[model samples]
Target: MTTVHERARPAAEVLEWGRATVDPAMREAVGALPDPVRHIAGYHFGWWDATGQPSEPTGKALRPTLTLLACQAVGGDVEAAVPAAVAVELVHDFSLLHDDVMDGDRTRRHRPTAWTVFGTGPAILTGDVLLTLAVELVAAAGPHARILTSAVLDLLGGQNADTSFEQRDDVTLSECVAMAVGKTGALLRVSCTLGALAGGATPDQVARLGLFGEHLGLAFQHVDDLLGIWGDPAATGKPVHSDLLNRKKSLPVVAALTSGTPAGDELASFYFAQPEFDPARAAALVEQAGGRDWSRERAAQLLRQALDTLNVAAPDTTATGELTALARMAVDRTH
Candidate 1:
């Protein structure tokens, strides 16, 4: 019930820092690449000025900010966490580059996706280079680097299962949860872990941070599911109801599909029968299936659990407040 003012930076400041972190070395690295690679990766990050010169494409570097914040919260030096912070952001961008290709998505962050501009092969290679760079950055953190690699591997594993789930109708709720834990939770967990490592937290503290990140990550996915269905395109910057178009088996969809209700039957019928359903129809279908309400309520519950884990981490009062603000900002985000 604490107001945002009770803790954390004002939302605007946090957002500013988040955007600033995305621009530095990674963009420079991409710009330094030879020929088509530079142009391709440059365009992906929105750095191409008119005439395809390097201009800035903006991103909210949420992962890196979280890494730095968590490090500070645990009394770690933010400077010490920079490598991990940058590493995670690089990995995140790398994932996005490849994910767009795999999802056949044409746009990201309100711009044409790397694959869309660069073609599949070059985009894939671009992701590869970034991923390698990510590992190198993490490795510079010394012993903690191995854990970071494991986190990336876990992310890849989760992504694999997620894509596979799209084709399979029998995916259970537990399986969905597991997939989310990997797909989203892994990097977040690593972020906290690295933060605690930088801060010299005890093993137990690191574990608690991992749990905090896990719960938060799960909550994040649930919120994303909500946004995917109902968020405005101007705000979300993605095609409205894109999840439905892709027939993405988000948590809510899976819950409704397995509910054994009349609505569930209708949902299954419509989803399988329609190949080219639009946003309005998809929203109608989701409503009929009771997914809208169910998802909102479920996401709320997961958010509470996430907060509980943060509480258990028992960060400093200021850090706790900041994290709470972060939680609110994440779930309460309209954009």
Candidate 2:
């Protein structure tokens, strides 16, 4: 394992190290699943193609990296945090599986989605299996099972709200933000919280790190919503103007709809008028209505808040620097 003091590795390198450290444990957990479910899970995880041949794995390993780093930041042994790391990663993947199915997404990580290849039922079942595995893995860790289950419940609530928003035009910015907190922030908060617990952190330290994760998670969603509008298809593995195409009332879109600017009115007209509206024009309207700028500014602000919380936790100096690097990389990415 790479020590934080060994050298100042880039955030990307830290992520790679985190992934490498957790992969064996992750694989072992997955290996315990029934064969059919395991096959779909492996396919979704980029471990193999539909035919079971080997394939290059994809994923930034962000959640698990946060878990390990949070442990190290609190002066806990990284190895002690491995199960927590794997557990969170499983939960993340489980969400992705369900998200793709619910969103009608055809691709992820530049490959066809598991639902598209293995059938929807199988994909959903695999997600359920993975989520079960997460709970089972964490059951031995004191307090971790309860923490993870609570986060899962919150995540489900957020997903429910997200789906419900699609049928209505009256979604408010606050409501949308609350939904993002559940949909994205819950798991991230738990990632840090569980890691801190595993590392034997003080209650105050755990709470502070959890706060940091909450801020970072919301910031991540803001950036993700931006990318959903303008990110390159090659990088995001989604269609151009994907959010607009789906008419998703994402943060920026909701901001624009509620902006009360003429551009906002026009965007609303375009958005709710018909199913065939132009996505590019809608993107332009969102920017004109200040949605893009607002989201960008909010993400930057939240990044600062997250860093402030991290500092208040009084973490190890080297781990603090690496965690800061990871947070910046997360907020500043193109995809």
Best candidate, lDDT:
2
> Which ten contiguous residues of candidate 1 have the minimum total lDDT?
21-30
Instruction: Give lDDT for model 2.
Output: 0.91
Per-model CA lDDT versus the true structure: 0.76, 0.91
**Which lDDT tens digits does candidate 2 get at residues 1-335?**
65444554689999999999999999988987888899898888889999999999889999999999899888899999999999999999999999999878887888899999989999999998899889988997665799999999998999999999988999999999999999999999999998888888899999999999999999999999999999998888778999999899999999999999999999998697786988999999999999999999999999999999998895446777788999999999999
Clashing pairs in 2: none
RMSD of each: 2.9, 2.2
> lDDT value for candidate 1?
0.76
Give the per-residue lDDT digits (tens) of candidate 1, residues 197-241.
777767877888777777777778878987888888889986788
